[model samples]
Target: MIFRHTRLIMGTALLAVALPAVPAMAQDADEARIKKLEAEVRALQRKVFPGGDGRYFEPQIDSSAPVTTTSSSPASTTAVTDILARLDALEASLQRLTGQVEVNSNAVRDLESRLAALESGAAPAVAADNLLPDEQPLPAAAGPAPTPPPAPAASGPSAQRLAAVQAIAKPQTDDPGDDEYSYGFRLWNAGFYPEAQQQLAMFVEKYPRHPRATYGRNLLGRAYLDDGKPREAAPWFLKNYQEDRNAERAPDSLLYLAESMIALGDTNRACIALAEFGETYPAIAAGRLSNQYEANRKKVTCN
Candidate 1:
């Protein structure tokens, strides 16, 4: 009976040892399988998101959520920042250019206004001879009155002498210094534009260096402007202004230049001319010319 009890105890001890080893083996196998599954998941993550850290088993965040930053290289980040800064600077530069353009535009508009005023407000030129005729003084009475002569008979020679005296007293048309220009000016004032143009052109050719040359040129331009032929008028105005910028008709010429430019759809040159007029003749700003400039500037929408 003792032998039988010993055999049973031995068998029980062996069985306990064997059972513990089986559990240990099972745990080792489970660890190997878990490691293999982790490796496979990492490979899948690499395939799905090539540059991402392979933490596939981790809980995922919502893709639609906003991200504050990305895992980008520092150099790349810096380059992106520099690009943004450059864009900002470029935008600022563009804004400055736009502001400068606006300033220039305003300056041009102001200049145009002044030019229009000067041109529109110029007074017509009057010839020096056209002023009041010379007044004749009455003959002074002698200290004692002379005795009156007997009345002469109305005979043939006496009548002929009287006729000659009457003819001499009649107003003469042949004033050497004042015929051509005066006639042209009269025609212009009377709205005989075609005849006036012809007369004025002839006068300009005949008396190119006369004191009234500037006035004649300006009047010729005016005739074209008034006749609605601004293209033809512009050259005359420009000529007058160029010939004698300080002459009485010079401002008139510049004014007409702007007007003709506007009429011809050459607003850019017209604006430039207008601006120059203001700069050249700052003194005209407070005169009637300024008023005329303002009116024309508004018409062109200069700014």
Candidate 2:
């Protein structure tokens, strides 16, 4: 994804995947952004190749001969200082473009991988969480009543508690991924919500591509939800879905997002999230998540 000057080819595939399922107006807006970015790129190219020929790999600092300025103009207007400033500007622009390309490229590759993973399955694109064995879903009636966001607890975890978690000296199990997740799950299940949140956050960060990572992210949101911080919880679920709907926990994240929305008294947005979940995971809505999905729909009063 890093666009080294030596390999600066922009592929059409990067341009091909507009944000999936975007409305026509949003699609147009995305295109406009791309066009603006393209225009900026072309402007940079022209500066790098003044002759419009791709002869130079980088902006020429001092080609062969040294440059000396002998001008009556102000010091700020001296050719060398101005040229140096322009070069600095060019380097900054290149860095910006490089970062943008890297992000877009990674997203495209992620989408492609998800497509391949879900090819045999009924759903379209989904997350690595899908590869793991399904966890028992919460009963519809078990959904929590709406609650306000909570203030932080008085203090951080006790030193002894941190030491115990750190002292968990299990050997690297064959399924370390499961081992990692189970530790956090155990913490959460035991009502160590803050500690569980911390450990789950760590698990997701350290093993982002692991099958359990996606679930860890959803669980992070759930931890917030269960802790009576729906304001804090909504974002995690919404973002997990927005980023990669193929994620095994993405449907769960969406469901939780709606739940968070309801808790926050945003029933209109809650209905919208429910609608999106139904639209994005129709088969899931009819199957594994059917009960929870239906419960959310009825709660939101969506048609």
lDDT of 1 by residue, 1-303 (tens): 546544644654554445545577775754554455444444444344534453543435434455334223675579789999999999999999999999999989876675454344222223566645742221111112111122346633356554643343222375533577777787778776755677777777678788888998889888878888665576677767867889888887787778887886766657766776776777874474888666657657554
Which lDDT tens digits does candidate 2 get at residues 1-303?
Answer: 236422433642366374546898877876766665554454455454556354544443333444343323474368669899999999999999999999999978865553333222211223567644742222221123212233358865679877866665433679887787888887777676776777777777678788887788788888878988665566566556655789899999988888887876666667667777787799999999999988877776755
The weakest ten consecutive residues by lDDT in model 2 span 137-146
Per-model clash counts, in order, read 3, 5
Per-model TM values vs. the true structure: 0.43, 0.46
TM-score of 2: 0.46
In model 1, residue pairs whose N, Cα or C atoms come closer than 3 Å (at least 3 residues apart or on different chains), thus clashing, are: 111-274, 117-292, 117-293
